[model samples]
Target: MNRSTNFVLAQILFVILLLTACSTEKTASDSEPKKKEPKKETVEKAPTEPEEMVKQGAGEHYEKVKDLEGDDLDKEIKELTKDFPKDMKSEDAYNRIIAAFAADHQLAFQELEDFDITFEEVEAYEKYSEEDGEEKKEGPLNVVILLDASGSMAGKVSGTDKMTAAKEALKKFAGGLPKDANVLLRVYGHKGSNDDKDKKLSCESTEVMYPLGAYDAGAFQQSLSKFKPTGWTPLAASIEAAEKDLQGKEGNNVVYIVSDGIETCDGNPIEAAKKLHKSNIQAKVNIIGFDVDNEGQQQLKAVAEAGGGEFQSVSSQKELFDEVESNWSKAMHDARINWSLSMDSSSVNWSSSGKGHSMRKVYSKMLDSISDEFELLRSVKMELYNQKKMTNEELDKLDKLIFSRYEKLREYSTNKHDAKQAALDKETDRVLKLIDENAENARVE
Candidate 1:
């Protein structure tokens, strides 16, 4: 119990207490439940054979059959598909083939569009003038009035003759026109009498009384007085003749046809109007049914639609005059804006010299080839299916061939497009700059 004995005893007791506390903590930890580690999720990557790769593989196979035709083509197809799995269902196999062909076709079209194939041709504007050689006002409004001087026009409408009403309306319309507008007066079916025997003469009676020129009120009135409604209606022939009358003239040309009846001379007015619409003259024809019946109005409406113009039904003189003036004003305004834009110096002129022209030609030819091939393949597939001569395996083989051809063409076009895009973009920028300058000038004017 001395000082040395007491120190040794205290050390032993402290060591025991530390050991007991460690053992108790370990027991408590072992009694509790252990937390389970979260299992790592394994995501399966999507099937690695991309459409592009499939197309590439198909393309290699396509080279073998591209040159084959007739029996040779059939023989090649049979040989290529001979190893296909026999257990595959026919419908399933057909669907797969169709899907592959569709993908390839889409890709081919996309690649083709990548090439800047648009040719920037410069527009040649012909300087129009009066017969006396004085240049017509340099605006874009050209109006042609087609008056129906047939027998029906002489018929009474709203306490006056249809012809009189039309004349008054036209005169009012002329007065409202802008000074810069060029106007023409064409009359049809005013030759022979409206008898069945004079049908031939009436049909061929189309004439341009007032040729395209500056609006001359006195001259147009004089021309109007000369025509009387004695002959049969010859609507179609007049339209056809009008196309020639405005042949070389440019700008927004509008034709206003005043009629009371349908064609009686076996001429197709709708067809004629369609031709005029699609012609290089860029004319729109508006039809005014002057006291016409339902049947006549319907036919006239069709003609107007074909000519890319509107149809107006007028029961009185006021409606006729109002419609004509409104349409003319609106059309002239639109034409002025359009003409200004077209004449802008920044617009692309496809006639320009350089690699652009050559590239356009090459791209055009490539497009034509691809189109022809596509059509040929489609026709062949359709023919075989219709004849029931093509088995599912054979169709699958053909699809592969199509896919390969498309893939090859796409690759070729893509390469060409990549090579030319930079140069094309530079040229485009130059054109755009010019357009911007022109637009500013137009706005200022």
Candidate 2:
């Protein structure tokens, strides 16, 4: 019974071992990694073109602008820019056009204020009197007359040669001058004939016939008689020479230039005047255009302004005398006032005011309009540049127009300011004169 049991157990053990070997072989087969197949090379098709860039309505507006001219162009530009987009490229083109239009339309107008009639403070008068006294008492009364003897002066006006009328006017002016004032007569274009052959010699003819000092009336008259109307105008050269003549002369220098036309010797009289004004002499220039035409008047006006002086146009001897007398009377009054104010401390103080507040407002509005237009143009120009519609050359033209408009505004402002100041000064002078006359009467009493 023991042997049979042991045999059965051995058989069962062998069956268990065969089952374990089969399970091990199956696990090994499941755990091993499988080999992957190689991937096929990808063939990328060529990229399709991007969608066409969409353009704004710049081309359409540009075409519209090109077809317009004058008022129509201006009106259209104004209408287009009225509601223009801030960031739109086509807006730039509109701005450029509008800027040019505004520049062309810029008009200069002056607003003059009424003179102030009340004094601010006694101290102000005292200060002004002190400065006036310093100028009045220290310098010698020096007067230099620049007489033009250009060929044009020989032409007849009102049945008399302009040169003869000019000389007669000068003689009267010289005679009326205060005895204390030192006189100098400088004549230009007095040498050489008006012929083209004599051009070189005429251009070089600028001489101080009478030096800056006391002169005999007869001698001065003779000097005037010596020269006849001949040669080209050397106006600029004559003024430059006058600067040297006045050098080292003290007190109250006045320069009077009598000319028939603009500079014919290619010299810049305006520049010469500017140099003389800025010099240490501190002279005041007064220009008399002796029957000068419109073009000549314009140029002479610029010279007078630049020289800090006044310009007067005269066609006859009577007109010349009137202007000269008026100027002299004013000068004499100013001198007397300065002297009196300096001597007397008991005089009452006076002040000045303006009368053009309403006009000034109008002027301000106009200036604001210009400024607004300029800013709009500037913005538009930049926009157009970004849009590539404006070339550099075209932008430069716009820039010049903008600059010109700005300059015009500035000049207008300056002129208005000067006019207002002059009016106030004249009123002040009137008041001072009254006070002076009253003081004299009191002293006489």
Candidate 3:
């Protein structure tokens, strides 16, 4: 073959050989199955939702009570309210509407063993001292003033009737009451006949004018005018009745028997005192001999011990007014204090340890809100109590005070978003720590 023809023929043979090899390789590659892609893995996650946020102290309190005074008829209807049900009540709703009311007010309900909380309203008085500073003690007082309704007390005692003097003393006592106070008043020797042909032994000389919040000057005076001192002095029955009424209502519940003369009930005074003492009624009784002789004093003192109240004698309206005012003031103060302490204790949550302390801080914050309300309440109460009673102007002032305080409180509560978030963060940390600690303890155990 020529050189050119041999090169061409060589090239063609090389090309054919390359094409066959290429086809075989391509066929081999195509004949082999394609490798499958590896399956993608998936992860499951737990579902969760965010907790609801609430205002710290955003709850409704007494929005209506402002400068309210008690009339004689409606005196007992001052405080009343209903509480939310636990199971059915929504936590969010409670936090929004009732948490403030349920918050503590710094009052503690716990008591140490072996202590009888005394309910004595003793005002510190000036007295000469020896070694220590001046000594002050509750002075002993036994007083009694017979209210004469035999068409006499209706007359004036210094241009303001005898009844007026008594009522003024009572009103003053109510007005000048401390946060804690209690008092009692008994009217007797009225013009109601306890004696009749059929009523041989039945003798009820006096009527209990009012019980607890029933002390009103006008009503009492009106009652006196309507009734007259009829039959003999059923002093024993009156004293006995007073003793029963004073059972649950005394620091050292006492009796001040105001009688014109003698006892008609066969019930003996000294014997009754002994019986009352025997019944675990630690009461003191005193007597006031109203125009009575030494014999009368002896009888009164004996009866006073029986009923567990003191007794004193006042011949004129002046002495009566003064003594009543003094005694009532002391009694009322003591009673109110007892009530205040009780209320305080019942409403407060006491803390002892760390966890308790934290809980207490929460309660304390709540109480702070409550205290603000109470402060406004007390101020409004005082303002209303004065001013010949309450006026619309006074009411407006109270409303303003309450509204402003509430508004400030509401702002404080509403701005607790940051705090709530913080609390949640803290809680998360706490729960984690608790879980870790518990797990560690379990491992150790």
Candidate 4:
């Protein structure tokens, strides 16, 4: 045991370490706090583990692999994986496996994006528009009032003339209509006198006093004043005029006629009223016969019945006022009902278009894509391992990188699903609330 003997033994130990450097396995004994490391082993640096190499080059490695695209990505991945590294290079292994299926990973990320969810498809929601002082009226219902300004309407009811009482009641009724509704006022038989000579002129008299539009108190009152009771009762002619006014107009339309008698001037009121009701407009024609005789009442009622509307006979001014008020109440009720029906129909299909449960489907697809990516990377790793291109250590490192990508993307998919679901709920509730507010304001008492 001299100096020569010590030098020869050290040289043999160095050769043993070099041979074992290619295959080193880590034992748990050195990792456990209670276990003491043996001093007989050499002070040489142990081979870096495959998992450690992956953890060390995590952030920058993932970014490099993610940015690679097109022919450049294809060339780099093919060249790196053509023959796996002879040396332990974790970066090359990550790039080769991860970059190969860039398009797949891109698609998975794209699915994670939240799509737009809205109530635009719902009819009521699509048509709803409200602003203070400025009208946004595309109303689904139009009310056309046909005033009979013939000589008989000049007759008396409660000492106040029929024409005066009717006009006053109508002006108040129109003023109280829901802001979203359109009002049209038409007058007939106001041009000629009640004489037989003016009969032809009176029968042909029909004019729109107030054009169809949003209810305006001032304009509507002015329109009502434009006509007076002066000519023969052209009841059939007035209703026909209303049908022409709403000829091509869309939505639920109605014609209300205030008359004191049946058709005069030899016109067929029943046939004319029937034709208006059955036309494309499908307008209901209600009649309010004020201060009329038994014969006039019976004939007026028949005309209304043929027109698919009710007839109300009134001898006093109070009856006229009450009837118009009833019409207003019914209009508000119908508006509420229409809105509720639209909401119910929309909710039935909300899962697909409104994203109620569709978010879960999107998330499920994202997870499947992540699994596909995980398996794809493993396939590349296995191909390298199957060929024995790289050492077992480098291939193990590539497996760690693939697992890392799977977990990161899985977390991302979950977060995106949660965020998207929240957004869908928020937007849906906002639209529903807006619908409620509009319906509530529709009551114009």
Worst 10 residues of 1 by lDDT: 121-130
Ranking according to lDDT, highest score first:
4, 1, 2, 3
TM-score for each predicted model, relative to the true structure: 0.46, 0.52, 0.35, 0.45
Residue 104 in model 2: shift from native, Å? 16
> Which of 2 and 3 is the better model by TM-score?
2
lDDT of 1 by residue, 129-223 (tens): 11333433444468888999998888886788889988888887766676777888889999999888998898899888888888888898898
| Candidate 2 runs further than 4 Å off | 1-136, 328-338, 341-430, 433-445
Worst 10 residues of 4 by lDDT: 41-50
What ordering of candidates by TM-score runs from best to worst? 2, 1, 4, 3
Query: Candidate 1, after superposition: displacement of residue 345 in Å?
Result: 24
Tell me model 3's lDDT, rounded to 2 decimals.
Answer: 0.43
lDDT for each residue of candidate 2 in 297-380, tens digit (9 for 90 to 100): 999989887777768788886767666666543343233224444324233321132223323444565566456545645654
Superior candidate under lDDT, 1 versus 2: 1
Residue runs of model 1 more than 4 Å from their true location after superposition: 1-140, 337-445
Q: How much lDDT does each candidate structure score?
A: 0.67, 0.65, 0.43, 0.68
Give me candidate 2's TM-score against the actual structure.
Answer: 0.52
Better of 1 and 2 by TM-score: 2
Clashes of 3: 35
**lDDT leader:** 4
Error of 1 at 226 (Å): 0.8
